[model samples]
Target: MYQKENSSWVKHADFTICDMLCLQLAFILAYWIKNGVGHPYETELYRNVAVVMIFIQLVCTFFNESFSGVLRRNMLEELKKTFEQCTLVCLLVLVYMFLMRVGSDYSRMILLVSYVFYIGFSYCSRQMLKKFLKNRRYEEGEKRSMLIVTVSSNAKNIVETIRKNNYGTYHLAGIVLMDCDKKGKTIEGIPVVAGSEDIISYIHKNWVDEVFFAVPKEITIPEQIIKDCSTMGVVIHMQLATMKSLGKNQIVEEVAGYTVLSSSIRIVTPRQMFIKRTMDIVGGLVGCLFTGIVALFLVPAIKIKSPGPAFFSQVRVGKNGRPFKIYKFRSMYMDAEERKKELMKQNNVKDGMMFKMDDDPRIIKGVGHFIRKTSLDEFPQFWNILKGDMSLVGTRPPTVDEWEKYELHHRKRLAIRPGLTGMWQVSGRSDITDFEEVVELDTKYISEWCLKLDVEILFKTVMVVFMGSGAK
Candidate 1:
């Protein structure tokens, strides 16, 4: 997470704002240069047209990663990207003009001249801005600090590799020796300040930006130590000779020519994620409208039958181990939680990490069975999604007690936000009683995720809900 923020290609909001400003100015300047001052400025009309044109170009720029190259360092690459963006922007505007049958309203010569000025000015502005930022960072004495974790035997090779590909982004601050007697030794001018046993304390006391684990194959780092770094929000890099141990889901990224495996739970593209969130917002609003109507009858029915609150909420673990209340319409008796302990032995799940029973005595008679079958009890969760506590499709949230019993590997499923419905809900949920199988399915959904997959699962869920195939 920290590395993502410090990446050289990460675009800045100021840079984007300046980029748009430069493009707009270039358009006006081109108009004046081509048609002379005799032509009316059309300030209002042209400004509006420029705004719409810039918006389209921004979309095209993002898709093409036009702003993803280091400006001052990669002038040639930046030039190429600038040309590509300019050509794409022109093509899109032409397509729009043709589609709207307004091609004759705009002058083709002005566009051609504007493209030339836009490309030239954009590249020059970026280069100047890059120099300004470089001077500022130099004056402030800011440099990305790195702490290398390796044995004395391989420290030289790691240091050399870093030097070869560093690209002026990182400078070694210190080294933590692993399985070595050289605690006070120096490796390539950097002092080996601590051994494996004292590494955690060193990390806590030092201002380390990144920790690179470059140990030998046989020497395994403790899982708790890794988790500690993650909890501290420090970026970690692990260099491996082979990818056999790390799962295939890992993405291999090169840093200064050194290859390392990087893993993330949300592997889908940013555009897809944005669309998913938009869908969730839209779906949540619609669901809440339906909930308002359903509550008219549900509130009366549930209260008259069970003599308790019409809704139920429980503490559930969300993404990154945060806790939040998950709301649901009352589908069980008021004493359901109290009676759960006595019914523990009745749990049907084989490798039990969760409790489930086909004929639980706690349910609120007819209303419970009907709502559970129809999935109407889950309607209240739309509020959770709208509040950003959950998603429209993700792994089901685990209860507090269930989370407490989780093993180290079991927590992998918590990397993403919990969802109202997911692969488990649509895929014979009641028939599957093994906790391990549930984890497998959740992991599979994350690894194979895409916008289309979410839509497909949602469609299957509607069918399952209507048929009452997977509810108990």
Candidate 2:
């Protein structure tokens, strides 16, 4: 039996003080820079104005509800609110001076300059502090550990979400099944500790930080479970049906009598979206720069051999099975798809929903052989990545015909947006012939996903592409 450790109130108080101190430092610096050394200090009038300004700013921030919950604030939204509050405070101070006929006493230049510097610096400092705390917790192995109480399907989804998101502070300790024949079994390597009856004893004995009730909303005794955990000082989280019902573009709202979690159907968290887009912009830019050099060299060679357009476009299935155009440099003849029918009998590759032809006749005389070996044909996909149609690392997009033949499990690949290069590309691309194996690799990638994995795959892809051993 492991008992969870709780941080003392003094520790929280200290951190809060640190937060306020940092904010105050920003204010002091802004004041000093905006007002020269000649400005009066410690005088009755100066002290009164300083006290009033600070009090009003804090009050306005409170009224804005900026500090409602440490966990509830969206990072970007918080920044915006902070800027707005700071701006309002500066404006109010200006109004006070005008009404009192003391406008000459306070420099307008000082007010404007300090307002900009203090607000921007304070907001940035707060964000940096948050990142520092998150990194420290991760490094200390002190993530918000949770015991999920649910069956495999529900537990699997929660586990995958936590594992995939680096910024999510949750670290799932294990799961507990409520009702099932495999009550004692584990789901995806997480142990199933005990049933409902043993939850209190188990939590008290173990160091459980949070208890996530992933059981469906239909379960009646969830409140009792929440109460039991509450007594033990463990935080409780639950999966609500309202979250599952929302569409991709729907707005989340909390009404007077109702609280619901609405989300996008794309299955991405805000942190995930931020990291993915950041990677796309950075990676896409680097890829485009390199591709430009390659194009300069390859374009001429490709033209000398085939005398056709240096690029190719094809329709592919995107997120949610939407149709989008995918791009590649021309690795085959202009009429490759049309000639595909003629090469069917000669197709050496076999038994895949997607097409893969070895020694393809549709390949151009010289460029096709080199393009497949070096994987240079796929370079143009950076444009697609930039356009938000694909990612630097994700499941390869499928053809329309191939996507149509997918089963429910196969469709899970589409749960994420497709990528230009992924686990399949680096995991012996040409050697892996079994479709099931490919799907398994893709599924595994999705389950154990992380930014680290994406980075590793990208690194390995470079090696694979250079070696040119696996591509047909």
Candidate 3:
């Protein structure tokens, strides 16, 4: 049941609300300054523009990851970032007004002045809020208490790192030096409260919300300590090796009645997974609507030219080796599968774990060129996404044969569900000739996944499609 702490957006949700209020106040004040003491909401044109501004600002905040590390940012960095976000929002507002043909009906000065006021108001509010939180949020008994268990050699470093990184979440209660008798001594100003012999007794006497075990390689950690901590209802964290050795993302979970250490580049909280699925559902519905429209035109062309059903379905490997039937518009002839073996020698990729080529002959001559160039062939994957067999953004699913040939490290791409469009598709798939390069991009996406990153990828996907860098 263990999961990551709150995401930045969830943690600073109040701050997001505060930002909206600041925008409202600043815009109202600007409207008064521009139009003799009246409000923007009173007018239809200005009121509509104001609503658009709010929507654009929310998108900017979420996609730009504006609130990330806000607590740690110094005043200058905060000021710069705040101004940049405000400016970007203003530019987007201008773009929207122009597209809607409402720019001429509005006072441009209102936007300029609103930006000015928003910068000052937001910066001051954030600084004040951060100061209050840093000073008062976890003062006295509000902070959760943590106990540390490590050898004397590693005690000071661990204590310092915890104190430095944890904002107001934890109060270091005490330390237990297993390899030495350092009772009543202090490391980084935290007292050594107990030795190994009296650890369980100390927990019984004092309140400890968590215990972190950073046992050294030479030290033999007692199995009784972990059981005792669990019995006492205290969260236990066994700190593993350096990030270089064990990878960045790590998790602890009960597997088949055994506690095991799992390391990958895609550790996630249940909340994050829920949000990702929500995005998939919303996007899937919209994509399916578009797919239905495209099928009306493209399906007839395929049937006229190719001599089979207009849809194609193949069993593709999904997340964690699960197989699912992936749907696609039938762009190739019925014997396309039989022809793939003959085309293997012509693969454009080196060390071809993946198959690709120029001017694939199995493609229906005129209709295939038009649909594949327009990426109309991929529309049916929206159904796969809706069925929960794929995501809107993830690694490309491989065929059953391709999956069987995957090396140990190459299988890491399947850590998450495959997608309709992914890092490989957007980042110059046609230009890339190395199969390893595709794996690298997918691994990078898995390691650094966030909702904001997903938004960014979707935007990039749009640009890639519009610019004629269509799917292969």
Clashes of each: 1, 2, 0
What is model 1's C-alpha RMSD? 12.5
Q: List the residue pairs that clash in candidate 3.
A: none
Candidate 2 lDDT over residue span 1-472, tens digit each: 2344333333234334444454455556656776645444455555565666766666554333344344335688768756866777778877777887777876666566667766776576667766665554463266677888876567777777666543556676777777654556677777888777777788889878888777776665556778878887888776655543454335546878777554542343455567767899888988889889999988888888888888789999987798899988898878888887776666543454666767777888777888878899999999889888999988998898789888887887776779978898799787776677778888778766766688889899988888887887
What TM-score would each prediction reach against the true structure?
A: 0.51, 0.50, 0.75
Q: What value of lDDT does candidate 2 attain over all alpha carbons?
A: 0.72
**Where does candidate 2 stray beyond 4 Å?**
1-268, 346-350
lDDT of 3: 0.87
Error of 1 at 313 (Å): 0.8
Q: Candidate 1, clashing residue pairs? A: 165-256
- lDDT string for model 3 (1-472, tens) is 3446786878888778888888889999998898878656978888888898789888888766788788899999999989988888889988998999988888879888998999888888889888877765576587888999999889989998887677678889999999989899899999999999999999999988889999876788788988888888888987865446776667767899997777777777666788889999999999999999998999888988978899999999999999999999988999999999989999997876888899899999999988888888989999899999999999999999889889998999999999888887888967888888998999999998887688788999989888878466
Question: Residue 348 of model 2: what lDDT?
Answer: 42
- True-structure Cα RMSD, model 2: 15.5
Q: State the lDDT at 208 in candidate 2.
A: 86
lDDT of each: 0.81, 0.72, 0.87
In model 1, where is the ten-residue run with the lowest total lDDT? 133-142
Question: Model 1: residues >4 Å from true position, as ranges?
Answer: 1-262
Cα displacement (Å) at residue 392, model 1 = 0.3
C-alpha positional error of residue 179 in candidate 3 after TM-score superposition, expressed in Å = 2.1
